[model samples]
Target: MLDALRIEIVEVSNEKVVARCPFMMQPDNTLDSFMGSFNSETVASVGSWNLLDMENEYAIGLEISANHIRGESEGTVKATGFPIHKTTMVWEIQITDENDKPICFSRCTTAVNKRIKKNNS
Candidate 1:
């Protein structure tokens, strides 16, 4: 059963991945069971999620603002290579296996965009 469950951070963006969840999403619902059964910090595994090259090629940069994030959070956001911002953020999870080796890693890339465009006028 354990062998059936494995985690890895796959780009899974655009043509990167044609499918979802390298592992099964549903698990036996028990007191210990969770939508995410990771045993480590969620951010430990993920590093950063960045804009696609195609995205960066368009404009000088995204007009990131508070609306770019869900809710009114002003926390630090980051892209894979970018230092930090509020438009795009990264979430990573790390889990160790019975052999005490780093086995599972999962990350999610979520973006927030400005609802309105601010004009310099």
Candidate 2:
């Protein structure tokens, strides 16, 4: 379960994409207890590049293929982090073509809502 909540980078052929944010820890408090206690559900992800214990310093660089003949790209994600179930993040990648031209560029926001229990709680 922890594996799904972490940030990662995937390389396909000559392109690499990095996804990350700033967050750490699984439920310090149980949901059963949490649901039964608070007036409102407290859910949030603070910081860009929501990486685990490590600080959020995320980046991705890719090399264009020799012939540039690919269409779509994707990869299965296997990562580890805290708040186990949900991890919120935003990812952006710019694909440059020959002559340093931007062939494709994309930005996506994945809001995985992983619950966390702060010490103040």
Candidate 3:
């Protein structure tokens, strides 16, 4: 899905993750501006699992809140995610345009779950 949207993971680490989406490749709204869903997707793509050291466990988004502060019609937009509360699996994301101007802000909460193995019975 990220490929379809042309979203690329530029960086990743235990403390932060960054992604980029270029306007030329993104789907636009009626006004030919960036879609808020792009911000949501960018925010969600960071996934809380990436920040955790636990193996065999993955995180699924429980809630997401995005604020589309401004619109951009051209250039690449960057989304950066950082842990808000590691234990609770909360994160904050900030999206900015090529000029480094604020485009969106978001917060996400996820639930960590053990990856269940399937029994081929």
Candidate 4:
């Protein structure tokens, strides 16, 4: 899905993660403004990316809520995720745009599950 949307990871750290998605119009020339699903995915991706840098656990999105303030028809948009709060098993991420604009504010809760290894025996 990320590939289809051309989402690119800009940066990642224990504190935050950043990503970019280019604006592309549909065949009808109508702007495919970043939708709720895309916003949700961005949040999840950032959170998961951060988790991957931290441990060998699988980060799965349990829940996400987004509030899109406005839509853009051109230029690339960037999403930055901040670790607002977190528990051992769950994390809360806040997303903002490149200009610090509230494009789609979201809170994502991710479940950090330990990776299980299969025994070849």
Candidate 5:
């Protein structure tokens, strides 16, 4: 889905992760605006990627809520995820837009999962 939306990961660190996407309108429309689902996905992607980078463990999104404040019809939109709180196996993430605006602020709860080894039988 990231490939289809052209979402790109621009940065990652212990504190935050950033993702970018260019504004693209629907085929039959000229709005050039993105859907709320896209904004939600961007938040989850950055949040999940941050956990993976920090812990070296796969993180599964357990819950997410996105509040879209505004929409853009031009320019690129960037989503940055910050770890506001965390437990041993879960993280609470907050996301903001490129202009430091609240495009779609979200809270994501992710659970760290262990990768299972496959048996080559």
Candidate 6:
């Protein structure tokens, strides 16, 4: 589903994760303007999930707050996620345009736990 949106991982490490996606106005937009909030949130969530890298675990978003600062209608937008206050489940996300200009800022909090195993008969 994400691939369909053209979101891709740009970088990943123990410290942070970066992901990018092409920006375009949603087809349902009547104003023909770029709606960046949804894409920004998606990248932020995905970045945090990748950074966690909890094997056999699940991470569900508890909260996500995004501030859309600037709009970019062309090229790709990238989001970088960093841990906040050294906490494993809280992240600060920054979204930038292709030229590395700030587009959005976000904070995400997620609940992490082991994935429940399914019983097989």
List per-prediction Cα lDDT, in the order shown.
0.28, 0.26, 0.69, 0.61, 0.58, 0.66
Better by TM-score, candidate 2 or 1: 2
For 1-121, candidate 6 gives per-residue lDDT tens digits of 5678777877776577778787664454221123344454555566556655466766777777777766566777777877764344777878787788987787777777677778898
Whichever of 3 and 5 has more TM-score, that candidate is: 3
lDDT of 3 by residue, 61-93 (tens): 778777776666778878888887876678788
Residue 49 Cα positional deviation in candidate 6, in Å, after optimal superposition:
4.3
- Colliding pairs, model 3: none
Candidate 1 lDDT by residue in tens digits, 27-62: 331212231333221222222222334333221222
Local accuracy of candidate 2 as per-residue lDDT tens digits, 9-81: 3322211232322223224421122111110111112222234343323322221112212222222211111
Q: Write the per-residue lDDT of candidate 5 for residues 33-115, one digit (tens) a residue.
A: 34444555456556666556443467666776666556544666666667766442233333344565555565666666666
**Regions of model 5 farther than 4 Å from truth:** 24-56, 88-98, 114-121
Model 1, C-alpha of 17: deviation from truth (Å): 26
Candidate 3 residue 61 Cα shift, in angstroms, is 0.8
Q: By summed lDDT, which 10 consecutive residues of candidate 1 come out lowest?
A: 65-74
Query: CA shift at 112, candidate 2, in angstroms?
Result: 3.0
TM-score of each: 0.23, 0.25, 0.76, 0.68, 0.64, 0.72
Indicate the worst ten consecutive residues by lDDT in candidate 4. Answer: 88-97
- 1-121 in candidate 4: lDDT tens per residue? 8888788877777777777777565554333444444645565656665666354566766776666566555666666667765553233433344565555566677766777777799
**Backbone clash tally (model 1):** 4
TM-score-superior candidate, 1 or 4: 4
Per-prediction tally of clashes? 4, 10, 0, 0, 0, 0
